[model samples]
Target: MDRTGKSDSGSSSMTTMGMVFVKAQNTPLYSKAWTPSTTGGYASTCIFLLILAITSRMLLAYRTRLERSWHDKAINRRYIMISGQTEADRERQAVGKGGEKTEVAVLTANGTDERVKVVRSAGRNLEGKPWRFSTDLPRAALFTVDSGVKYLLMLAVMTMNVGYFFSVLAGLFVGELAIGRYTGAGEGHH
Candidate 1:
Protein backbone atom coordinates (compact mmCIF):
# COMPACT_ATOMS: atom_id res chain seq x y z
CA MET A 1 0.00 0.00 0.00
CA ASP A 2 1.14 3.54 -0.84
CA ARG A 3 0.23 7.04 0.36
CA THR A 4 -2.58 7.06 -2.24
CA GLY A 5 -4.20 4.11 -0.45
CA LYS A 6 -4.22 2.07 -3.67
CA SER A 7 -3.11 -1.57 -4.04
CA ASP A 8 0.41 -2.08 -5.48
CA SER A 9 0.20 -5.87 -5.47
CA GLY A 10 0.03 -6.07 -9.26
CA SER A 11 3.56 -4.75 -9.77
CA SER A 12 5.05 -5.84 -6.46
CA SER A 13 6.59 -9.05 -7.78
CA MET A 14 8.25 -7.26 -10.69
CA THR A 15 9.87 -4.68 -8.43
CA THR A 16 12.55 -5.36 -5.88
CA MET A 17 15.08 -3.41 -3.85
CA GLY A 18 18.30 -5.18 -4.93
CA MET A 19 19.48 -8.66 -5.76
CA VAL A 20 16.62 -10.83 -4.55
CA PHE A 21 17.65 -14.50 -4.57
CA VAL A 22 14.31 -16.06 -5.28
CA LYS A 23 13.15 -19.06 -7.34
CA ALA A 24 10.84 -16.94 -9.42
CA GLN A 25 9.30 -17.38 -12.86
CA ASN A 26 7.82 -14.66 -15.05
CA THR A 27 10.68 -12.40 -13.99
CA PRO A 28 12.57 -9.98 -16.16
CA LEU A 29 15.95 -11.38 -17.23
CA TYR A 30 18.56 -8.82 -18.32
CA SER A 31 15.79 -6.51 -19.54
CA LYS A 32 12.04 -5.97 -19.38
CA ALA A 33 11.78 -7.21 -22.95
CA TRP A 34 12.78 -10.68 -21.71
CA THR A 35 10.21 -10.91 -18.92
CA PRO A 36 8.69 -14.36 -19.09
CA SER A 37 4.91 -14.24 -19.07
CA THR A 38 4.44 -18.00 -18.65
CA THR A 39 6.14 -20.91 -16.92
CA GLY A 40 7.12 -22.40 -20.29
CA GLY A 41 8.59 -19.09 -21.36
CA TYR A 42 10.72 -19.00 -18.25
CA ALA A 43 11.85 -22.56 -18.84
CA SER A 44 12.77 -21.65 -22.40
CA THR A 45 14.75 -18.70 -21.16
CA CYS A 46 16.62 -20.93 -18.78
CA ILE A 47 17.46 -23.28 -21.60
CA PHE A 48 18.70 -20.40 -23.67
CA LEU A 49 20.96 -19.30 -20.84
CA LEU A 50 22.25 -22.84 -20.46
CA ILE A 51 23.15 -22.98 -24.15
CA LEU A 52 24.81 -19.60 -23.96
CA ALA A 53 27.02 -20.72 -21.11
CA ILE A 54 28.06 -23.82 -23.01
CA THR A 55 28.86 -21.74 -26.08
CA SER A 56 30.99 -19.44 -23.97
CA ARG A 57 33.06 -22.39 -22.83
CA MET A 58 33.48 -23.51 -26.42
CA LEU A 59 34.64 -20.05 -27.44
CA LEU A 60 37.22 -20.02 -24.69
CA ALA A 61 38.58 -23.33 -25.85
CA TYR A 62 38.88 -22.03 -29.41
CA ARG A 63 40.64 -18.89 -28.23
CA THR A 64 43.15 -20.95 -26.29
CA ARG A 65 43.81 -23.07 -29.35
CA LEU A 66 44.36 -20.01 -31.51
CA GLU A 67 46.75 -18.48 -29.00
CA ARG A 68 48.83 -21.65 -28.86
CA SER A 69 48.99 -21.96 -32.64
CA TRP A 70 50.04 -18.35 -33.06
CA HIS A 71 52.67 -18.74 -30.36
CA ASP A 72 54.15 -21.73 -32.16
CA LYS A 73 54.23 -19.82 -35.45
CA ALA A 74 55.97 -16.91 -33.79
CA ILE A 75 58.60 -19.22 -32.34
CA ASN A 76 59.16 -20.80 -35.74
CA ARG A 77 59.55 -17.38 -37.33
CA ARG A 78 62.12 -16.36 -34.70
CA TYR A 79 64.12 -19.53 -35.27
CA ILE A 80 64.11 -18.94 -39.02
CA MET A 81 65.30 -15.38 -38.55
CA ILE A 82 68.02 -16.37 -36.11
CA SER A 83 69.26 -19.16 -38.41
CA GLY A 84 69.73 -16.58 -41.20
CA GLN A 85 67.98 -18.78 -43.73
CA THR A 86 67.27 -17.04 -47.01
CA GLU A 87 64.00 -17.45 -48.85
CA ALA A 88 65.66 -19.25 -51.81
CA ASP A 89 67.47 -21.67 -49.51
CA ARG A 90 64.26 -22.34 -47.52
CA GLU A 91 62.34 -22.98 -50.72
CA ARG A 92 65.00 -25.32 -52.07
CA GLN A 93 65.22 -27.22 -48.80
CA ALA A 94 61.42 -27.51 -48.65
CA VAL A 95 61.23 -28.78 -52.20
CA GLY A 96 64.15 -31.19 -51.79
CA LYS A 97 63.65 -34.90 -51.21
CA GLY A 98 64.44 -34.64 -47.49
CA GLY A 99 64.54 -31.51 -45.41
CA GLU A 100 67.97 -30.53 -44.07
CA LYS A 101 68.76 -30.36 -40.37
CA THR A 102 70.74 -27.47 -38.91
CA GLU A 103 72.94 -27.96 -35.86
CA VAL A 104 72.69 -25.17 -33.28
CA ALA A 105 75.37 -24.85 -30.55
CA VAL A 106 74.09 -24.43 -26.99
CA LEU A 107 76.11 -23.26 -23.97
CA THR A 108 75.62 -25.47 -20.94
CA ALA A 109 75.60 -24.37 -17.29
CA ASN A 110 78.96 -26.10 -16.56
CA GLY A 111 80.69 -24.12 -19.41
CA THR A 112 80.18 -27.10 -21.74
CA ASP A 113 78.87 -26.83 -25.30
CA GLU A 114 76.08 -28.96 -26.69
CA ARG A 115 74.75 -29.28 -30.23
CA VAL A 116 70.98 -29.28 -30.89
CA LYS A 117 69.41 -30.49 -34.14
CA VAL A 118 66.80 -28.16 -35.60
CA VAL A 119 64.62 -29.34 -38.46
CA ARG A 120 63.64 -26.52 -40.81
CA SER A 121 60.29 -26.70 -42.52
CA ALA A 122 58.82 -24.45 -45.16
CA GLY A 123 56.02 -22.26 -43.94
CA ARG A 124 54.53 -18.83 -44.46
CA ASN A 125 57.14 -16.06 -44.50
CA LEU A 126 57.12 -14.03 -41.34
CA GLU A 127 59.24 -11.12 -42.68
CA GLY A 128 56.25 -8.81 -43.18
CA LYS A 129 54.84 -6.25 -40.74
CA PRO A 130 54.32 -7.40 -37.18
CA TRP A 131 50.58 -6.97 -37.30
CA ARG A 132 48.62 -7.90 -40.39
CA PHE A 133 45.11 -6.62 -40.83
CA SER A 134 43.96 -9.94 -42.29
CA THR A 135 44.83 -11.95 -39.19
CA ASP A 136 44.63 -9.32 -36.43
CA LEU A 137 41.27 -8.03 -37.60
CA PRO A 138 39.64 -11.46 -37.37
CA ARG A 139 41.28 -12.06 -34.01
CA ALA A 140 39.92 -8.76 -32.76
CA ALA A 141 36.46 -9.63 -33.99
CA LEU A 142 36.61 -12.98 -32.26
CA PHE A 143 37.74 -11.31 -29.03
CA THR A 144 34.88 -8.83 -29.24
CA VAL A 145 32.35 -11.61 -29.68
CA ASP A 146 33.89 -13.59 -26.83
CA SER A 147 33.82 -10.60 -24.50
CA GLY A 148 30.26 -9.72 -25.47
CA VAL A 149 29.08 -13.24 -24.69
CA LYS A 150 30.91 -13.29 -21.37
CA TYR A 151 29.35 -9.98 -20.24
CA LEU A 152 25.91 -11.03 -21.40
CA LEU A 153 26.17 -14.17 -19.29
CA MET A 154 27.30 -12.10 -16.33
CA LEU A 155 24.30 -9.82 -16.70
CA ALA A 156 21.95 -12.79 -16.86
CA VAL A 157 23.34 -14.15 -13.61
CA MET A 158 22.96 -10.71 -12.07
CA THR A 159 19.23 -11.06 -12.55
CA MET A 160 19.28 -13.27 -9.43
CA ASN A 161 16.57 -15.60 -10.58
CA VAL A 162 17.24 -18.95 -8.94
CA GLY A 163 16.13 -21.06 -11.87
CA TYR A 164 18.11 -19.01 -14.33
CA PHE A 165 21.17 -19.10 -12.11
CA PHE A 166 21.02 -22.83 -11.72
CA SER A 167 20.51 -23.27 -15.37
CA VAL A 168 23.72 -21.38 -16.12
CA LEU A 169 25.57 -23.42 -13.52
CA ALA A 170 24.35 -26.65 -15.01
CA GLY A 171 25.36 -25.55 -18.48
CA LEU A 172 28.85 -24.57 -17.34
CA PHE A 173 29.24 -27.86 -15.51
CA VAL A 174 28.16 -29.83 -18.54
CA GLY A 175 30.34 -27.82 -20.90
CA GLU A 176 33.38 -28.25 -18.68
CA LEU A 177 32.78 -31.94 -18.45
CA ALA A 178 32.66 -32.11 -22.23
CA ILE A 179 35.68 -29.93 -23.11
CA GLY A 180 37.55 -29.38 -19.86
CA ARG A 181 40.24 -31.92 -20.69
CA TYR A 182 41.05 -30.15 -23.95
CA THR A 183 41.43 -26.69 -22.36
CA GLY A 184 44.01 -25.58 -19.83
CA ALA A 185 43.19 -25.01 -16.17
CA GLY A 186 41.51 -21.64 -15.34
CA GLU A 187 40.99 -20.94 -19.05
CA GLY A 188 37.21 -21.22 -19.08
CA HIS A 189 36.52 -18.25 -16.83
CA HIS A 190 38.58 -15.86 -18.92
Candidate 2:
Protein backbone atom coordinates (compact mmCIF):
# COMPACT_ATOMS: atom_id res chain seq x y z
CA MET A 1 0.00 0.00 0.00
CA ASP A 2 1.08 3.59 -0.64
CA ARG A 3 1.06 6.67 1.61
CA THR A 4 -2.69 7.19 0.99
CA GLY A 5 -3.28 3.54 1.98
CA LYS A 6 -4.22 2.72 -1.61
CA SER A 7 -2.55 -0.03 -3.57
CA ASP A 8 0.23 0.83 -6.03
CA SER A 9 -1.96 -0.35 -8.87
CA GLY A 10 -3.40 3.20 -8.95
CA SER A 11 -6.88 1.65 -8.52
CA SER A 12 -7.27 2.38 -4.81
CA SER A 13 -7.12 -1.38 -4.31
CA MET A 14 -6.42 -1.06 -0.61
CA THR A 15 -9.54 0.97 -0.06
CA THR A 16 -11.33 -1.38 -2.42
CA MET A 17 -10.73 -4.56 -0.44
CA GLY A 18 -12.87 -5.37 2.59
CA MET A 19 -14.88 -2.19 2.27
CA VAL A 20 -17.85 -2.42 4.62
CA PHE A 21 -21.42 -1.59 3.72
CA VAL A 22 -21.79 0.84 6.60
CA LYS A 23 -18.78 2.87 7.80
CA ALA A 24 -20.78 4.94 10.29
CA GLN A 25 -23.84 3.12 11.60
CA ASN A 26 -25.61 6.36 12.47
CA THR A 27 -24.66 8.71 9.64
CA PRO A 28 -25.13 7.35 6.15
CA LEU A 29 -23.01 10.07 4.60
CA TYR A 30 -19.88 8.86 6.38
CA SER A 31 -20.59 5.27 5.45
CA LYS A 32 -18.09 3.48 3.22
CA ALA A 33 -20.57 1.52 1.12
CA TRP A 34 -19.79 -1.38 -1.20
CA THR A 35 -22.03 -4.21 -2.43
CA PRO A 36 -19.89 -6.53 -4.54
CA SER A 37 -18.11 -9.56 -3.00
CA THR A 38 -15.47 -10.46 -5.57
CA THR A 39 -11.72 -9.74 -5.36
CA GLY A 40 -12.31 -6.50 -7.30
CA GLY A 41 -15.65 -5.81 -5.64
CA TYR A 42 -15.02 -2.16 -4.85
CA ALA A 43 -14.29 -1.28 -8.45
CA SER A 44 -17.28 -3.26 -9.59
CA THR A 45 -19.56 -1.58 -7.08
CA CYS A 46 -18.39 1.85 -8.15
CA ILE A 47 -18.93 1.10 -11.81
CA PHE A 48 -22.38 -0.39 -11.14
CA LEU A 49 -23.53 2.58 -9.12
CA LEU A 50 -22.19 4.93 -11.76
CA ILE A 51 -24.20 3.31 -14.52
CA LEU A 52 -27.32 3.09 -12.34
CA ALA A 53 -27.13 6.77 -11.49
CA ILE A 54 -26.71 7.68 -15.14
CA THR A 55 -29.54 5.44 -16.27
CA SER A 56 -31.83 6.67 -13.53
CA ARG A 57 -31.24 10.28 -14.45
CA MET A 58 -31.79 9.49 -18.11
CA LEU A 59 -35.01 7.63 -17.33
CA LEU A 60 -36.25 10.59 -15.29
CA ALA A 61 -35.56 12.95 -18.17
CA TYR A 62 -37.32 10.74 -20.71
CA ARG A 63 -40.25 10.39 -18.32
CA THR A 64 -40.60 14.14 -18.27
CA ARG A 65 -40.73 14.25 -22.05
CA LEU A 66 -43.24 11.45 -22.10
CA GLU A 67 -45.40 13.28 -19.59
CA ARG A 68 -45.28 16.39 -21.72
CA SER A 69 -46.29 14.53 -24.86
CA TRP A 70 -49.04 12.73 -23.00
CA HIS A 71 -50.37 16.02 -21.72
CA ASP A 72 -50.35 17.46 -25.21
CA LYS A 73 -52.16 14.50 -26.67
CA ALA A 74 -54.71 14.47 -23.87
CA ILE A 75 -55.42 18.15 -24.22
CA ASN A 76 -55.81 17.94 -27.97
CA ARG A 77 -58.13 14.97 -27.91
CA ARG A 78 -61.85 15.71 -28.32
CA TYR A 79 -64.05 13.18 -26.63
CA ILE A 80 -67.59 14.28 -27.52
CA MET A 81 -69.04 11.95 -24.97
CA ILE A 82 -67.41 10.96 -21.71
CA SER A 83 -69.73 8.18 -20.50
CA GLY A 84 -70.98 6.91 -23.88
CA GLN A 85 -73.61 9.60 -23.98
CA THR A 86 -73.40 12.02 -26.90
CA GLU A 87 -73.84 15.76 -26.43
CA ALA A 88 -77.23 15.67 -28.18
CA ASP A 89 -78.29 12.72 -26.06
CA ARG A 90 -77.31 14.61 -22.92
CA GLU A 91 -79.22 17.69 -24.07
CA ARG A 92 -82.26 15.59 -24.82
CA GLN A 93 -81.99 13.93 -21.47
CA ALA A 94 -81.65 17.32 -19.85
CA VAL A 95 -85.08 18.29 -21.18
CA GLY A 96 -87.94 18.50 -18.69
CA LYS A 97 -89.20 15.10 -17.49
CA GLY A 98 -92.74 15.96 -18.62
CA GLY A 99 -91.59 16.80 -22.18
CA GLU A 100 -91.98 20.48 -21.36
CA LYS A 101 -89.05 22.64 -22.52
CA THR A 102 -87.48 24.15 -19.44
CA GLU A 103 -84.33 26.31 -19.35
CA VAL A 104 -81.82 23.90 -17.77
CA ALA A 105 -78.94 26.00 -16.64
CA VAL A 106 -75.98 23.68 -17.03
CA LEU A 107 -72.93 24.80 -15.09
CA THR A 108 -69.69 22.91 -14.45
CA ALA A 109 -68.43 22.30 -10.95
CA ASN A 110 -65.73 24.88 -11.64
CA GLY A 111 -68.32 27.07 -13.44
CA THR A 112 -66.66 26.43 -16.80
CA ASP A 113 -67.60 23.93 -19.48
CA GLU A 114 -64.25 24.41 -21.20
CA ARG A 115 -62.91 20.89 -20.73
CA VAL A 116 -59.59 21.45 -22.52
CA LYS A 117 -58.78 24.38 -20.27
CA VAL A 118 -59.64 22.33 -17.22
CA VAL A 119 -57.55 19.42 -18.42
CA ARG A 120 -54.55 21.68 -19.04
CA SER A 121 -54.85 23.14 -15.57
CA ALA A 122 -55.25 19.71 -14.03
CA GLY A 123 -52.06 18.55 -15.75
CA ARG A 124 -50.14 21.41 -14.18
CA ASN A 125 -51.51 20.66 -10.73
CA LEU A 126 -50.85 17.64 -8.52
CA GLU A 127 -53.97 18.34 -6.55
CA GLY A 128 -55.86 15.10 -6.89
CA LYS A 129 -55.89 12.30 -4.33
CA PRO A 130 -54.33 9.02 -5.36
CA TRP A 131 -56.60 6.47 -6.91
CA ARG A 132 -57.64 3.49 -4.81
CA PHE A 133 -54.90 0.86 -4.63
CA SER A 134 -57.25 -1.96 -5.60
CA THR A 135 -58.38 -0.18 -8.73
CA ASP A 136 -55.01 1.37 -9.58
CA LEU A 137 -52.36 -1.13 -8.57
CA PRO A 138 -49.96 -0.30 -11.37
CA ARG A 139 -49.91 3.37 -10.43
CA ALA A 140 -48.89 2.64 -6.87
CA ALA A 141 -46.33 0.06 -7.94
CA LEU A 142 -44.68 2.38 -10.45
CA PHE A 143 -44.70 5.20 -7.96
CA THR A 144 -42.85 3.06 -5.44
CA VAL A 145 -40.33 1.96 -8.01
CA ASP A 146 -39.64 5.47 -9.23
CA SER A 147 -39.28 6.94 -5.75
CA GLY A 148 -37.18 4.06 -4.41
CA VAL A 149 -34.77 4.09 -7.33
CA LYS A 150 -34.36 7.87 -7.08
CA TYR A 151 -33.64 7.83 -3.35
CA LEU A 152 -31.29 4.84 -3.56
CA LEU A 153 -29.28 6.55 -6.26
CA MET A 154 -28.96 9.62 -4.04
CA LEU A 155 -27.89 7.53 -1.05
CA ALA A 156 -25.29 5.72 -3.14
CA VAL A 157 -23.59 9.05 -3.81
CA MET A 158 -23.32 9.59 -0.03
CA THR A 159 -21.06 6.52 0.17
CA MET A 160 -18.08 8.94 -0.04
CA ASN A 161 -16.27 6.94 -2.68
CA VAL A 162 -14.58 9.46 -4.94
CA GLY A 163 -15.13 7.31 -7.98
CA TYR A 164 -18.76 6.62 -7.13
CA PHE A 165 -19.54 10.24 -6.28
CA PHE A 166 -17.98 11.60 -9.46
CA SER A 167 -19.79 9.03 -11.57
CA VAL A 168 -23.16 10.15 -10.22
CA LEU A 169 -22.33 13.81 -10.70
CA ALA A 170 -21.20 13.22 -14.26
CA GLY A 171 -24.33 11.18 -14.92
CA LEU A 172 -26.63 13.97 -13.79
CA PHE A 173 -24.76 16.51 -15.91
CA VAL A 174 -24.86 14.33 -19.02
CA GLY A 175 -28.48 13.36 -18.44
CA GLU A 176 -29.49 17.02 -18.24
CA LEU A 177 -27.66 17.70 -21.48
CA ALA A 178 -29.45 14.82 -23.17
CA ILE A 179 -32.83 16.00 -21.93
CA GLY A 180 -32.16 19.55 -23.05
CA ARG A 181 -31.23 18.28 -26.47
CA TYR A 182 -34.55 16.46 -26.77
CA THR A 183 -36.62 19.34 -25.37
CA GLY A 184 -36.70 22.80 -26.90
CA ALA A 185 -33.01 23.62 -27.41
CA GLY A 186 -33.68 27.38 -27.69
CA GLU A 187 -36.57 27.92 -25.29
CA GLY A 188 -34.33 29.75 -22.85
CA HIS A 189 -34.74 32.97 -24.85
CA HIS A 190 -37.98 34.93 -25.23
lDDT of each: 0.71, 0.51
Q: In candidate 1, what are the lDDT values of residues 1-190, reduced to their tens digit? A: 7755455874443333675787779779877998999989999999999999898888878887886676556546423223355656655544533333343435457662323224443344334427957568877987899899888888888878899889888888888889877677777564
lDDT of each residue in 25-134, candidate 2, tens digit only = 22223243434445356565656666676666555555556546655554443323223445675566445233423232324676635222111222333334344454
Task: Quote the positional error of residue 67 for candidate 2 in Å.
Answer: 1.1
> Candidate 2 regions off by >4 Å?
1-39, 81-143, 183-190
Checking candidate 1 for backbone clashes, the offending pairs are none
Report how far off residue 69 is in candidate 2 (Å).
2.5
Candidate that would win on lDDT:
1
TM-score of 2: 0.45
